[model samples]
Target: NDYGKLGRAGEAIAHSLVSSSAAGRVAYVEPFAPAPGEAQLGARNDRGLLVFSGCGTPPTGQHEVARGVVQVAELNNPVLLNFGVSEVNWWLHYEFAPVCSRTVLVAYDKLAEWDMMAPRKPVLEQVRAQLLASSDTVVGLSEGSIDDVPDASYVGHGVDRHWHDPAIDSLPEPADLAAIPRPRAVYVGALSMRFDVEAVRDLADSGLDVVLVGMAPHPALVELAERHPRIHLIGERPPEQAAAYLLHSDVGIVPHTDEPFTYSMEPHKAYNYAAAGLPTVTLNTAHAPALGPFLNATRDRKEFVDGVRTALAGGRLSPDQVAQARSLSWNRVAEAILRAA
Candidate 1:
């Protein structure tokens, strides 16, 4: 299947990297099956890269994906095999080793250091060691250290700046957004354990209409929405549609619970909010200082409520602030990777 059909961080990177690649310079291979009938292999030119898709359903194992990747890799004779961490599924990427002249790993997050991910650390550590031995370079998010590998590069996650902009103000408002009373305070990422439910409730109690634009599988959050008329759980949206929600909203927020894992993140949502010209207010964290001046880091629930009011008053980001965010585009990130390779 094509990455474009999905809506996740990995899909975002795949789109950016492929869009940045020169015509016919990159190829993507994945394990996929359109039906239950037979093991099928097919290739097509998508965007700029040749995509080899469809292996089989209930995929037998990693070897099946590896075999297809090897065939495509040999044909393309790629200079670098760029690997992004996808948790346990990374084992599949490991199988495609030695296919390219060099290997590079994009450390999307520091799962090994996260307490919740402790159970998988042993296997991840083993993979880390193997990756270190084989990788020519390791690029990681700036919020966390990448000392596991020598001389690893630390950089922030990138956004497709054009996709989120003040110009979206001229576009039609999203149907679901029309009835949500403003001044709207929006949060546009996962509603996971890291999310601060208390903080959101405080904002709603303070009279700000709170909008959450991601999956709300967590039962607590669902109940909170049921109790708070001001709080709206609008469900998950694709990149483009999600950006519109940010652009139309009064302010963007990251109400993450004060935790080590929360401190370890440099959220792509903040970057997206900045690109959309919203004043982003986030819960204070260790990485807050490094996130630049455009983001307002509030220390407590009271501060968070105040931060939203302050953001609503100040309005969207200034021209210079927008430019700063725009400069950090995925095109530049892809260029850096290509140059490093």
Candidate 2:
């Protein structure tokens, strides 16, 4: 599950970071029962371990000696370490602190707030405080993300160089997309709550060809796409295929909503867009400013629409900008983490 078979950002990050080096093996240590389609067993390699660490399942009593440990405190899930591994150095990332040794808490998104009627606000705050207090190092995905945590270092999201590289993967324009009108604006990623539905609607209504390439389409998103003839929904393509669309597109759009969750986000689409050498127009978020002159971060709906038009007219990012983007690879990110650990 860590090294994803599908094209998810977190999975891509895990795969790239773990697979780049030969120093350690990655294995999944799950402690939960399989949910029908889910894999029951964990995967291992020569170097490290990548485990699901599922809940409620009993340990298998198999003890493997571990050289070093990097305990990742994933934001959405609990860290269930029932693996009988021995002699491991632990490193933590993000919210939970099962065993807080050499911890690196990553603030990738603002804490979630589900409902006002049945509130979890206080609970969320307490968790954040406990994690922050226990963490040895607090890292932010963007410069703005560090504001909540004092003295936190900004280590932006890492891009998989191989998947986004045009040389390794051919960027052929799919015939279906090629038939679409000129000045194509492609958005790649999940079509979920994070997306600004209004902005996307506007883009579709603006007479420009809007192509959405991703999975898990929110109902609202599906309705919007259904309403517009110009909006093409080609759901859930593989990384290379998705990259091909981005590479062939005139511009890439990051139509994220302005919300508490988005405030701390540094979207991987920005890096992918830069890697493809396509002009990008993103909603003005905390991380957008740091991306330099390559991206146009618009403040409002008017600006978002105008930014897209402007990007279509403007040329691609300069060689220096592209080089800068390439430098933010997962290889570099993994090295930084290992050094810190």
Candidate 3:
């Protein structure tokens, strides 16, 4: 249940904010159950603040803006500090962060606008000025959100090294899903419209066992499953156990429909698959370039299938390549992030 998805981002903030409390300063680390809702929430007195979200590009709509702003208003907690919140998720965060604090907080931009491809600089700037005029103390990964509040220890982003090890490079496949004679490939995560559902269907019929390892897709995907037995649609699995399947698979797939966020957003599964040293075949997306050197990419169906085929036929990576992937440990990322944050 305690996956490492937000370890890097969450740890960064915790590292910064926890010690700032007075000796009597009450401290709390509220990592939510399903989605670690709210940024950092803690208080020593009646006055407190909420760090909700950052709006990127053209910034999210006005309703979203008001929603995030109102979250604190409802909780009577307004200290707002924006930290790399996706514009899409801002409203939800807005509704959530205010549960504890309402005092005006702080904002920083240096780390706020990081996705390089963002388009709403002007909008974010406007919101920044609006927020700054009202915050108490802004101390974190932004350029100039806080005027008087000196940058303090980080409160967000870092690695969970305990989960990182060369051992990930050799995760064994699960027998429950691999007992059949099928050669398997894995795709985990949302199976919504944007994923390469059609392409997966095609590959499923090509006589390879294509095992999807995420929540079930729309009803259509199931219909496709009925037609293609090779397309073994095994539902989602626990993170720890499914990781073994990732390692044993002939190849991994990130066949996205090639959208912006899907491309721009860094998919941890790719990093995890890399850690397993399983050659990954992906659709052309923004993250592909960053991870391409370590991956094989194709936008064409034939080429994609062939890439998966070649990677499988080539057998496992040499010991050195596996070691190289292992070197990019989540723990190392965690340490660097903690120091930087």
User: Best candidate, lDDT-wise?
Assistant: 1
Please write out the lDDT profile of model 3 over residues 74-184, one tens digit for every residue: 523332333433332233344334443432232323323443435775565445544444333334332222323454422221222323554654566577676745467
Rank the models by lDDT, top first. 1, 2, 3
Off by over 4 Å in 1: 5-10, 19-24, 31-45, 53-67, 70-76, 85-93, 145-150, 161-169, 284-291
lDDT of 1 by residue, 108-183 (tens): 5555656687888787667666665667777765445364555777656666545546565566779999899988
Q: Pick the candidate with the highest TM-score.
A: 1
lDDT of 1: 0.69
Model 2: lDDT of residue 75: 20
lDDT of 2 by residue, 1-341 (tens): 23445444444445555575532433343233445453333334423435444323222222211211233322222221111111111222221244323455555554533233126566566666665675666665565556767666666666665644547436578877888887789998878657788898888788888999988988988998888888889888877667778878888898877765565566667888887777788885555554677777777887999889988888777777777777777666555544544
lDDT of each: 0.69, 0.61, 0.51
Superior candidate under lDDT, 1 versus 3? 1
Q: Please list the Cα RMSD from the true structure of every candidate, rounded to 1 decimal place.
A: 3.8, 6.6, 10.2
Per-candidate total of colliding backbone pairs: 0, 19, 29
State the lDDT at 147 in candidate 3: 29
